[model samples]
Each structure stands twice: as C-alpha cells, then as structure tokens.
Target: MRTATVSIGVSNRHVHLSPKHLEMLFGKDYSLAEVKDLGQPGQFAAQETVSLVGPKGIVEGVRVLGPIRKSTQVEISRTDSFRLGIKAPVKESGDLAGTPGCMLVGPAGTVSLSEGVIIAVRHIHMSPKEAKQLGYKDCDRVSVLVEGERELCFHSVIVRVHPDFRLEMHIDTDEANASMLATGDQVKILGRTQDALDLVG
Candidate 1:
C-alpha cells in the first residue's frame, strides 16, 4: 500500500466574505485586517467578526477568514447547525447550491443571504508537486490513518491540489476532537479509494 504523511489543520466555524458582502457587513471601502496566516497560501484569519442569525438562535463572534472570495460562505460544524436550526449540508468549498442561508450581522449593517451555508467536507490541500509525490490528484478520495489513543482511519477524504496550496489535511473541530488531533499533528494517507476496492475485489 502507498502511504504518505501529512500535517493536520483543525478548522473552527468561520465565514468567508465576498467583496460585495464585505462592504455590506463592514462598510464601503473597508478591508479585512489579517491577524494570522493560515496553512493555505494567501488565506488568513481576519480580526473582524460577524454574528450569524438563524431561525432558532444566533452565533456571535464568528471570525472572518480572509482574503475575500468571489462569493460569501459560512462553514459551521454539525453542532453549530443544530444550535442555529439550519440543516447545512456537508459540501466542498464554493459548492453552495441548494444549501441554507442566514442573516449576517455586523457593526455597520447586515446581509441576508439566499444560500451560502455549509459544513465543509474534510479535505487535503496540496500543491501539484506534493500531489504528484503522493501519487494522488485533485478531487481524489483517499483514506487517512490517525495514530493515538483514538487511532482510526478517516475515509472519503477529498484531495484538493493547486499550485498555491501547501500540503495539509483539514478537518473540522468535531472530527479533530473525535480523533484527538491538533494542528501540525502528522497523519498517514493510506491509499486512494480505488486501491481499497481493488484489494477487496
């Protein structure tokens, strides 16, 4: 079996704003203040925050991730979904069609979205060179083996390869807690889904 080690990035509930939405939420000509750079290139945690208001309740102080995207998106955990009474589907970034939307409250104003909320699917971000070295390609499903007291294999993890990406496996807070994983913790990619199917066949 082919195996490769990769670092983990545990993601918390956050929001990505589009240029238009950012202006609506923060005010015209406003820009995001970068507090910290993320594992992925050109991505950062902005100092600003916004409140997400749903049918049942409101989740406040949700950090905004930067730089701005073409469209705004909200990535929350399953627990967060229940608290907000939103049935957000597990989807890849930018795959927001037919998903739920909510009201975003900011200091300057508020924006009501038609659809843009999702529970981001766990995925690995790797550069093309790294992907080639790992024998994987973009959008490939693979299994990852975690080691520790709660050691287990994570299945159906999608691979995202790009020139600007750095090698890192991103999981939500819930998944990280279940496996007791932290940022920079190393995990092994066992093989692609086809490899497992071939073995079974």
Candidate 2:
C-alpha cells in the first residue's frame, strides 16, 4: 500500500457508423493518426479519426476502421457528447453489455445504426515494469467503481500487463459520465488502499 501502482481509467464514446457514413464524414480530409496492434488474427490494426470538412460542426477526431460485421462506432469524449447534443448515458463501454445501439444525424442524412455509443470495452495494456511493481499479472482483475444509482463495483476488469501499453485505465464514454469523472481524476487499484479499499466491490 505504499503506492506501488497507480492506474487511471479514461472512457470514450463509441458510435459505429456505416461504410457510406464513414466516407461522408472523413472522405475529404481523413488521415490516419495511430495504429494500435491488437493481437488479433488476420486483421490489420489501425485506428484513425477523420477531419470532416466543416465550420458547420464543433467536433473533430474520427476513428476509422476496416469493414466490420456489425455497427460502426464513433467514440466521443464527454465534452464532445455535449457539443453534439447527443443525450447518452456516461456508462462504461462494457456497461451497455448487451444493448442494441443508437444513431447520429449528419448533414447528409440520418445515419441510424445502433442505440447507444457503448460497446466492447478493452483493457489498457501496461509495461512489465509497472506490472511487476504492482504485483499484477497479464489478466488480473481489478474492481472498478461503477458510477451512479448504487455504489456499484465492476469486478474482473482485466489487466493486460505488457511493455507496449502505457499506464492508464481505459473505459468507454458511458463510464466517465456515470461516475462524473473527468480528465485528471485520480483512481487507483481497489485493494489495501485504505480510503478506496473498503469501496471496492
């Protein structure tokens, strides 16, 4: 409990747009920023946020993806959600576990795909040095406080200990809002922290 590990979770909104929709928003000035190598098989690993031609909207950053079997997701920060006038819950991306989805109205037409911008939350990978110092393994579960209503505890949050992932907690847009947590909010692992240990679900 001597502050060996300090992890923070940052959540973003995900909205799955259609192929045509993707091109429409970013066809003109879409550029790839970073490609994250997810150890997935046979698929290319790249994430891009496109620049829509606009003084029309107050939003930027488009995360691009290859063809998928399901919906196209657009991740928005809490601030971004407010700017877009999208009334969505600030739940964890995984919190909307088995929900249908939501839609977005663009300048072109209404892009209706899903109901909520929450889905497929993943673990933030960490370096071995960090993991060893924290006494964590590649898939250790940490209890995250679920925001709102009840003082909920999210159990089994996976830890992907590795050298590549930077130290951070990764949550979807939903979680950030429900917890009313913003950028630079301090969070830690839920064990023997005294102040937070008792609240760990």
Best candidate according to lDDT: 1
Query: How do the residues 1-201 of candidate 1 rate in per-residue lDDT, one tens digit apiece?
Result: 359899999999999999999999999999999999999989999999999999999999999999999999999999999999999999999999999999999999999999999999999998999988888899999988899999988989999999999999999999999999999999999899677667767
RMSD of each: 1.3, 8.3
Per-prediction count of colliding residue pairs? 0, 25
Task: Give the per-residue lDDT of model 2 (tens digit) for 83-198.
Answer: 55554454443354444333444434445544545334435456788777766677666655544443455545677765656666666556666666654555555633234555
CA lDDT, candidate 2, residue 93: 32
User: Which window of ten consecutive residues has the lowest lDDT sum in model 1?
Assistant: 192-201
TM-scores for every candidate against the unseen true structure: 0.97, 0.46
* Candidate 2, residue 85: how far the Cα is off, in Å: 16
